[model samples]
Target: MPLPTADTPWPPVDTRVLTSLADWDAWYSAEPERLEQRYEGRGSLEQANRPAQYAGGLRGRLARWFWGQPTPAGEKSSKLHIPLAGDIARTSSGLLFSEPPALISEHQGTQDRLDAMAKSLHPTLLEAGEVCAALGGAYFRVVWDDEVSDRPWIDTVAADRAVPEFRYGRLTAVTFWTVLDSGDTNDRRLFRHLERHEKGRIFHGLYEGSLTALGAARPLADHPDTAPLAAMVDAEGGLDTGAPAHLTASYMPNVRPARAWRHIPSAAYWGQSDFQGIEGLMDALDEAWTSWMRDLQDGRSRIIVGDHLLQSLGPGKGVRWEDRRVYTGLNMLPRAGDPDPITSVQFAIRVKEHADTCAALTEQAARQAGYSASTFGEHGDGQAVTATEIKARERRSLATRARKALYADPALSDILAAQLAVEAGFRFGVTGLDLSVPPKVEFQDSVTEGLGELATTAELLRRAEAASTETLVRMQHPDWDDQQVTAEVAAILGESGRAVSDPTMTGAEGPGTHGSGPVE
Candidate 1:
């Protein structure tokens, strides 16, 4: 076959950035780079045409969307990133957040991808493992799965590029790759070999990595938990065939209200690559993101409202966040009187003007926020609106939108999945991922009355029995102990025996963190 040419199209990218409204228009108008050669689809499909297949919250919706789609074998598939048309609103404060090239989907070439793409969401899916690249290690893939993935992402065969005139819109794109069991799609793997050239350029002004303990090492694309990333890495057992490497990135959802953020980005980072080693990748990202944030903050502090698009120098300066919406969706409800939901500390950078504006609007919204109580209109004292009232209004807005958005679509079974993903991002440290079907969180809680917390059921009892044995041995030998020597020794031996037999570890500090199945 022809050696992969340097002139080949770059690999898939999911980076989301904000360009000036004018610039964004320009980019859209710009000529297509390589598509003229192969894909010549008429711009008929658009995000609007596609149903918002996610709803039960982002996470569960992902699983539903994925499980619902039929994955062709041997490749990893994923939604590059999602774009909400709403963010581009004319809030007059926050600038637009855009993932140029709009939403995207891609496939990774790895063994994990091959296995993940071939199964149904079921109990045995977790123990799934595969070793493809058949004998002679030429062209073959094998997969053995034990657990079903909770969330899955599907991509349409071709994307609809032409969008209507800027009426303000959101876009979410996905990546789909061929899989081992997916006989027909196998031929698509060749397309992945063509995407390597389009990786995002490093921005010395923005840094996503740090030596700090909590810093992010990879972008959302490289995250291990992402089903798409796993499948991609395991494509055709690429590793077995010694394929060039790729990595996944981690993208934490910035659900925090845009107001609380010390800084906000005009756009969010969608995904990244795993090539060139973690350290090198980190090195390239660190300085750039850091500086970009700083600059945005520097410029945001001074907002001369009226009629203008926002801009920023970076972080750590004058940003009018009061006017920005912040991620109002992420605000937390801390207590009864406190205003504003406890938003996430992770902030992105936008402009100083945007910051101040966000801050002001948040305060206005908070002050105007309604609440509930025995009484409704008790005039006089300026004791801000009742929490119940505010919630009522918010709920109304949400309900109205839900009626229209896919959030309430009964047709798709992803509502639960989407809700889970959104919950995980907020509750757990997890972002949107193709979570495996919970596999039944069957908790054999110690409440099994007869078990008596004495090491509880099998696992815990075994541990307690073992500990008792040591105490008994010490007692049996007076010189080494306390209580009745011989009798205690007998009891200790008995407990020890039971421990060996049952082998329980109830109430032990905690069990292993790895999954029940062996590591691949």
Candidate 2:
């Protein structure tokens, strides 16, 4: 959704539903401190003078593992082992795991209390509904492969060796939402909630192209283990009926792509995939997403839990037969990412300092784990390892070793600068084209000692059309702040030369100057 811009403004947010700008702003503003912390912290340093520091604290979720290993026999399942509190009071076969099942221990009292059981089970059913609701759809990756990946093509080979075809995919989110509307309650069921519109949406997403008739599809037993749990309830008992029905729903897929295409134009910008792959990647993005939607709608209802009354109680008439039990399980997802703002900034910034060669490899690892076109990311999204683990994953080579050996030398930053400059020019299509910059004859300032005025790297190249006397001197510094960024950008604009320096980094380079530099 294209949200409203701050200046354009919007109306007050609806407290009932997220309907206005203030609500959205409240949602978005919770994290602005991350940015402010980044800007305020850290000073100037040589971009190429130091070894890459380990991502100390602020790496968010890593991707997840998605082998895409095929579903088998047209029947797929993921196990969830739930923790339990106690044994049931009874046991039976083909049990419904019915709503309002008795929780009173046989150890306490085996007789009467049918009304109490109903009252107690009513809340238990309600609690189960609440727990399901708390599953909270926050993170799940599904996407189409980007057409521009260095690797070409992916075959979604099913367990039966069926090859589904497609190409483009980027990361996408998977979300769930429940629907509520008036529905006639089943005499057996005490509660109900379903609206025509919500059902239509679910049906449309699921049965769009399926050949099988919905009626003919077999409903899966809620849980096989629950069948043996029916012994606790009295065969003919229980009273009271008013209760709200509970159901689960999925909202929308949250596609946190490697980059925000609209906010970001170039690959060098962090928060997106660096310059990799081609333009056609967006094409394959749809199928993977819609297919999953289809699966969710068609298969979900069949597996949902619902209670069916085998027999009913006559008005004011009851007996001493117990009839309910519960034998199922549930699971929850843990949180991921760094808690502090400074750490996140550093993690992303460091990725850039390395020119992103390593981050790419990490992404490559994600892909191999089953994130092709139709998936957002695999691995890491849920994994929250410390900086130690991240740094351990960095790429190493003999050149890195030599570079490390000369860490203290001034020439070292120069060498690192050369390498980064080459990468920046090569990947971002930004060469050190010069503009009419002041001659680098002097470099004395609070920001930097003995640096001169700055100009676009492009302007410096046109010696005939512009200031030709502007000389460029190269100097390396580390830091990502106002003064440091200003100077680095000045250097970057004058980067066409072997050594470019401008201590007064006041001039923000037009366009391509990301100022993610020591001199920006």
Candidate 3:
């Protein structure tokens, strides 16, 4: 499809898409004000006026608690936000990338290139993974600049910033856009730079538009950011990528089906956000934390004194509590057997109650988000369990990580293949390298077995004569390649004097005889 032209609708996205993205972004940001604004914009006027009526379902109750019960004017309560949403996103990324995945290619040169790329792109991939988890998906675009780097580099675009075209649930093309300049609110002059990526070419266009409409298509040189790209544009207004069979961009969804927008066909291709389905639980968790803090604040002890006890500072000045040990001729007695004026008051803090509430909400949210409560450090009893017991506790989380890895592997393979294709087609770096095959993406295990446990298992296998030396070595160091394993096995045999020498054949003796003796 062609790029959006003049008078085209801005964003070209459904309202539901916008709303979902906005809510996910707000929660991922973990800003209390942002969340409050989102909740305020939802529901009806009656619901807004009577928050008690809003407490109907789980979400409504959470919203009521998070926004607080209706308070008198100028008596608004403080709300605190726990960054559990952000933590979930970060944990998702860490689970997948704490140990970088290996992009292995059969060809030696291609493997070398992949290794070099992985070294530089590991951190970028982690950041992209986090954003992907938070926003439901991310886009990987391959671009090159000889001035910046010799080879094509990868860039990540957040899901909200791009309009993707998919064929049969596969991404065919994507247009990434950014607002270069936004004029005054009244003027409504917006300069948008759009880069559309397709199989063999990238189209760049600048648009002078309003927030709701693309007013007109401007020349590339009209904007400072797009000016340099003017020199690269061909007669067709796109830079020929030279590789026509493959796309220069790929979409990596966080997870499949995008349950939140499954009803909306246009947005269904997007991935599901980590914060989806459990937003209310997270909000309630935040509310619990906020209420706990409020308890601390309101629990401070304060002395209640009569007007006679406080000394006047000066004219037009407020009275002050004199730091005196004793006062003479002061009215110490209460009127008509009333309570003492000098009584102290302090409210009790519901620590255990709030702690339990917060813990329960956090566990529910984590579980609802496809992770175990223990994944977020909510292990019951806080006991030190064996690795087997720990794995049992985090079975849900491990399964989740495996699912995410499955989704990521293909997208990563495609993008890395595109990168290699770009380099080989342009002859930019490492010429004559094979780019016909895409590399395989192998993610390291999220949970590694203890060395001692692995050694014991290997010993048992060896005792049963089931595992070979090479197999034992591989089990001990799963990260090692075949060559490393072979070398280690050979060294072990040689060091143990168990290396078998070829039997010598003597004419006098029978063939296949060992040493100088014949077969007995």
Q: In every candidate, how many clashes are there?
A: 164, 84, 0
Model 3 C-alpha RMSD to native: 4.7
RMSD of each: 26.4, 33.9, 4.7
Per-residue lDDT of candidate 2, residues 362-472 (tens digit): 344223221221122223466655433433442222222122222212211222222222222322333332211211111112122222223344345545553322222
Ranking by TM-score: 3, 1, 2
Model 3 regions more than 4 Å off: 41-77, 182-188, 314-318, 323-339, 380-386, 427-430, 481-483, 504-520
* Residues forming the 10-long window of minimal summed lDDT in candidate 3: 511-520
Better of 2 and 3 by lDDT: 3
Model 1 score (lDDT): 0.25
Candidate 1 lDDT over residue span 293-410, tens digit each: 5565554534343211224546865434345656345434455654433233334465555445433433332222111111122222565554444445344332322222221121
With candidate 3 superimposed using the best TM-score fit, by how many Å does residue 495's alpha carbon deviate from the native?
Answer: 3.8
Worst 10 residues of 2 by lDDT: 85-94
Error of 3 at 204 (Å): 0.5
Comparison by lDDT, 1 against 2, better one = 1
Instruction: Give the alpha carbon lDDT tens digit for every residue of 1-520 in model 3.
Output: 2776657887988988888788889889888766766676443333444554356887566546454444446776477889998999999999998889998989898888888898888887898899999999998999888779777899898999999998778999999999886535666589888899999899998899777777798888988888899999886668878788889999999998888688877787889998888877887787789889989999999888777778898899989777678767655555875567677899999999999999899988998888998888885787756677778889998899999998899899999988888887854645756777889999987777787789889999989999888889999998798889878887887787676544654344554354532111
Model 1 residue runs over 4 Å out of place are 1-7, 11-173, 176-388, 391-520
Best model per lDDT? 3
